[model samples]
Target: MSTQQEQLDFIERHLVYDIFKDFGPEASLEFHKVECSNGLDGFMSALYTVTLELVIRERKRTEVVLVKFMKGTEEFRESSNSYIQFANEIFAYAEILPAYENVLRTSHLESEVVSNWVPRCYFARFGQVEGLSNGRESVLALKHLKNDGYQLGPRLILRRDHLEAMVGLIGPFHALGYATRILQPQVHARLRAGVVDMPFVSESGKAIFDVLYRVAFDRFYEFYDRQKEQLLKDTDPGFGAAIERLREKYFKQPTQLLEWIRTNSYAADQADSHFATFLHGDYNRNNVLFHYGADDKVDGIKAIDFQELRFSTTAIDLSFFLYMNTASEGREEIYAELLRKYHSHMIQMLELVLRRNQDELTDDRGAELLKEYSFERFNGHFKRYAFYGALVCMHFLPWLLGNEKDCAELSRLFDTDMHGPAFHQLSMDIAGDEANEEIFKIVRHAYEHGYMDEI
Candidate 1:
């Protein structure tokens, strides 16, 4: 919608004031432009790399920064709490992550220290313009990881090694979140008030699904029609009856579907809050970035997109990674191994974090907290919370596996009429033999494995 200039203008006005205090006076803008970050990277917002060639101290230097700007149709933004969502992310980087770092640093640990698990956010503000209604004034500027060789792994199904790296990292980091709550309750409460649960369970969060549920399924119907005629018709018969059954059971009637979605999304806010840990909230593949080391192996990883970061149970985060990011093949084959590996990491990290608080939190209290989230309890929690994985995968994989071009086009449609003829065309374009086959496999696996039944 030609809003890049507006975003850049906002950054230009606030750059020196917010970030560059002493050096800004000598620095002059030399060059700047928008770099494309496709829809898969950010569906709810616009992503761009802004390079400012500045003349500082009579020398020319270039600084490349990543930017996330609010994007989506006007109606979608309002319905989904897009403005507030952006504010939530800004809170994560500006307030939450730093407080976490401070907590770990101040802990009386005699062991290693863990860094906060995100890229540095240089500047963040939500809707600071005159009206604040239009989200043009919203932007989050961060240190660009891509410039330093961090890259996104495969889009569709992640390899086993990548999955291992992700679990290994977040497991311990989650412990740190709870550690903060135990060590610094006042700080923890302040941060929680600032962060909002996202995408699925605010007052208006579930309401957006009313419009989106039908739109996505209607697109699926068009995709199914094309597949049946072009491919499945001769290969497999009676597919239509199965599709009709699914539509009647889940698609046509969404009362249970919505309920299942809400309960699993955050687990009805839980009974005892001890079961809750800090969550990456939406820990899908798009939100994770990987770094390959000398042997071409994944040596390190960093997280992106804190828009959905909140405090919740680890069940949904684990389920989202397993279900939404991994391919059906990966999900089926390494699912148990992944779970065990993550539980192991959580155990190790929980011990490490609790030990730091032993003087204040006490051994008896620490033992109780550990008992609350034992591996046995974790397995059962996954059963109930895994439904979140099934729901979001349907939306993520269809767009990601088909084509980046389609996703980019679909992302642009966020600022357009999503139910119009153009959206239908894009939806059709997003369906492919591989994409359709992969997504249906996920749905089939969900049904067969009783993930749907558990909900």
Candidate 2:
């Protein structure tokens, strides 16, 4: 094993200098300070921040970059089918992102680069693309967002401004794929064919989800048992049984729907092709970071953890983000506006990108994309597909919303392949916390909307 100092030295020389030399001809790296980092809900990667002190043209400056080494052990990687995840992430950062930015650069309308929405990946390597990796020694480096004043919001906190900022970006994130299809069909085709959403599609993938699902159910039951007495005290004599029956019926629907999705994920329904786009797939407070201005308002955001990224209907990204971060009430209020924002922006991007290539798409033909892609068509798919958002929340929220200790404990257990009674107890504490009211809100929204019935 490489010692920590040796690794830092390698990173500073091989990684940091390569990324920073572009700062200027006179730019020279003094050194880099490496610090480890992990979020409460972060369980997938070994992360670190490398701050480099550089002198550029006689001026001293400090630049911070992030480095992510693959974290899944051989067995864990095999069981999770993370090979596909790693491949997709590396493909996105290395291949897809640059092409997307190129489309914008050649467009008629002014556009921000992909790095504005996602971090600027300085370097990335994974199996099958840049060479080979055995789920180890895979490395990705990127400009650290914290260096740009971005911070992760609380796991359960849902501020409207933050949601709006994120919703605005989701449009362009997916829009780039649409634009690429129109502007660079060959490149788009290459990417669509290359990336695979295999995390939950294979038998091993299904097994890992089953383990997580089992833990969610067990913890909820434990919490329910612990709270049943007081829960009944404030209710009618027969209310306890009524709730127990409802609860049993309630959770099962998502389990069924989630299993259904595992079978039908990334389904390219012809009727919904116009609305099909890339999905961030995983979007929680952990995966998205926000930058606030001096007025304490969110003006910008960045998305990370493209491990679950895939090409799918836009609803998957939209609903997953809103439901994961916003409670039912908050989501319902802004949901329509968010849908409008994403659709409009996506269409706008498509129009602007095709403006110069009238032979490919004319003003009349460009406008037809909007005519063909209607809000009603898009919203209908969202209603049918919104359950995906709820189900992901169900499987993950129990552990993600837990306290710091719970996250650390869960990570250790997950890494060691030891999901035992001890794991159950930690999950019970997480699921049982009285503050976990939002999970019920997610369930109620799905139940009220008949998401379960659709399955």
Candidate 3:
């Protein structure tokens, strides 16, 4: 373990010094190591450094900044680098900033255009370090919104207002991608190549997917086996049929399903004639921070976690937010309205991108792209991919819900000898009636859309 003095020494060498020079000889810093009993895979610690200043300076003020440090195991560190490389590839066409100026300017311009919908980026940087065998680190310094707070993670239920705010932000974020396509066509093309035709098909991603699918299948069977009686007694006949049909199709023929996935994994690799633009791959509520007033209505929203940014269909982002955020009981009622809102915002932004960069993309081509890649068409893909999404939800829900007990059983079923089964089990335990209903709704939506047709 790194001692307090050792940590302080590391900080003295790394942190900007002019900000800390004012502290008297007796002034000391405080360190707090946050325990993520919640079972997340990362090392997070918050440092609160307080210093007293002399009277000589024109500004005699105390300085306090919260530094959140995240570190990973050797394997995880390597994986994080690969992830950063992927992000860098997406931004290759655009200028990436070590300072906040460029990102701030871009964000301000976007906010003005979109009005009520933009996230603020404070600072971002990538550099090498001496610790852990001189590995590189990517650090993002963000404005700490003490007043604004975040809701529960994606697994939890989302309020109507929360849903509305999130949907509103999607329009402008997607528009930014479209704008990039027009203003920087060549860059956009590069991003398209890098994002859609991801090396996942060829790289370690193939092995990762192979393992993930097998684990997913095994878990599905365990869940099915354990809940067989309950499934038979399910009140909704349609729901029972859907589950059984899925089991008969996928459970008995796991290899066939895996083969099918392997075949279609490259389906979106080729950028179709449809519109392609920048996409926030994991645009869930968890990544969206909400600013709420006394009334609990959303005043502002900012997005975090750019780890999954890529170039692809706008619908991919929209569907992720919708499926992950919305609950079961009210989803059908709000789905149409939310979809309409997303479309309207997207078209408006698309128009802006075209108008600003007339030479790059003609109005006709832009409109054609927009129409071809409309949300309606994309929803079809969402329905088809809903099973995969559900599988992901099932696997992680226990951890998210803070159910640690059943995590071991869940892990064993997945054929992974890793720890943290308890955390996943805790998550499953915490998922209340509302979450169950939400899961059912998603499954029903898939069924109604004929997602199980082939089965």
Candidate 4:
């Protein structure tokens, strides 16, 4: 009966020895294990290992490969299976680059032509072959990244040049969605089904969403107060009044708000649109990885985290990306430019998808549906829902702001510091100037756009 840590150590050694057996005793191996701490559930820990060896047959060849392992309890084994199945499905459709190959290749090719965006696929599998019963299991794999990098949550915030180069990468992702719709209508439909209505449909899941939404809104109000005062002093009476009205309409009417959410929760299958295609659900700076050149110019951009991929108005993803990533100071100035770039890429993709599936898309009805479901209008139409989005954003903002130490301070105000200082620290970190400004901007935007009135 070895302890979990001891078992982990033994497993690592065994894996290294088994995989690099040809390297003989001279082969070197290193292991690093990081506990999942960002409120992530259902896992023991994530481990990274590096093995170095020289090929005995090819004496001149030396190689170093990295392996990732997901270790978890028996309970997690079931959930891990679901996750593995999902990952396998994604991999089956697209080659697994260390990051996103299609996005990187599309961007690279647009700037400088490339033959193909597909990557060389390696093996992928769950940790347990027999599956966990009562103990823990370790799943592992190896891969090579052409570029050394780390992920910022779901997004890849790599070197600066990588960020800029990503603009081109977006083109190809948009292209692929369009191409899929045209060339493989049934496949596209199936992918859409997989994305929008995947398993997570339990009543408990809905309750969790409700709780998250409430937490998000409460946090938004706390931040919104600062902006209300500022706008009042600045003589923006209309904006101030709108905020008050919105508070009355939505925040004060929690029951009504929940009812509205429940009513609108179902996916809408409105009039057809030609522009519809697979949308990157969580497109943002965080989800994108950039390869940089000298002076921080982006040489390449790779979009990752396709777990939320689904069929929707392209505007949903594009708007979210711009709103979340762009700075507040320059947002208004760059809004049109961003929209232009997004739409241009989207239009090109739509055309390509149509061209490939001329017979399937011959109806032109889909295009009309898309035109009617314009992102700008959708944003305005769903501004109340922005509260929901903003709430989700708040959950991650503390990490983004690099504040996890002030949780205790926040807990003091709440009367019980069950989570101790860490919770307060996170709250304090996220309650910074930038976050406040962003929250206020959203509040003000919602007010001015008449979202408050209808809510």
Best prediction by lDDT: 2
By TM-score, the best candidate is: 2
lDDT tens digits, residues 1-455, model 3?
A: 23344445554554423234335554443432211122322222223332323333344443333333334444543433444543352243223221112222443444344323323332233444343124444433333344236433335667778887877777766666656555556755555565433322223432333344344455555555666576447445676677777777766434454344323423566434234455565677766778777897877776655555654455456655776666666777786678778777767766655555456667787677667557766555434443544544444443345454444444343333222454234344444543454455565665665655544
What is the TM-score of each predicted model, taking all chains together? 0.79, 0.84, 0.67, 0.63
TM-score of 1: 0.79
Tens-digit lDDT string for candidate 4 (388-423): 334335444543544434433443333332223444
Give the winner by TM-score: 1 or 4.
1
lDDT of 2 at 98: 80
Model 2, global lDDT? 0.68
lDDT of 1 by residue, 152-263 (tens): 8886678777999989877877777767777788988887777765544334324445445555566566567666666454433344455566577767534356455444
What is the Cα-based lDDT of residue 189 in candidate 3?
Answer: 59
Clashes of each: 1, 0, 13, 31
Residue 160 in model 3: shift from native, Å? Answer: 1.1
lDDT of 4: 0.45
Candidate 4 is scored at a TM of 0.63
Instruction: Identify the runs in model 1 with alpha carbons over 4 angstroms from their true place.
Output: 1-3, 22-43, 46-48, 52-62, 72-76, 108-116, 127-136, 197-208, 215-273, 421-429, 447-449
Error of 1 at 60 (Å): 9.0
- Predictions in order: lDDT: 0.67, 0.68, 0.49, 0.45
> In candidate 2, which residue ranges exceed 4 Å CA deviation?
1-9, 38-42, 128-136, 199-201, 204-206, 217-256, 259-269, 433-437
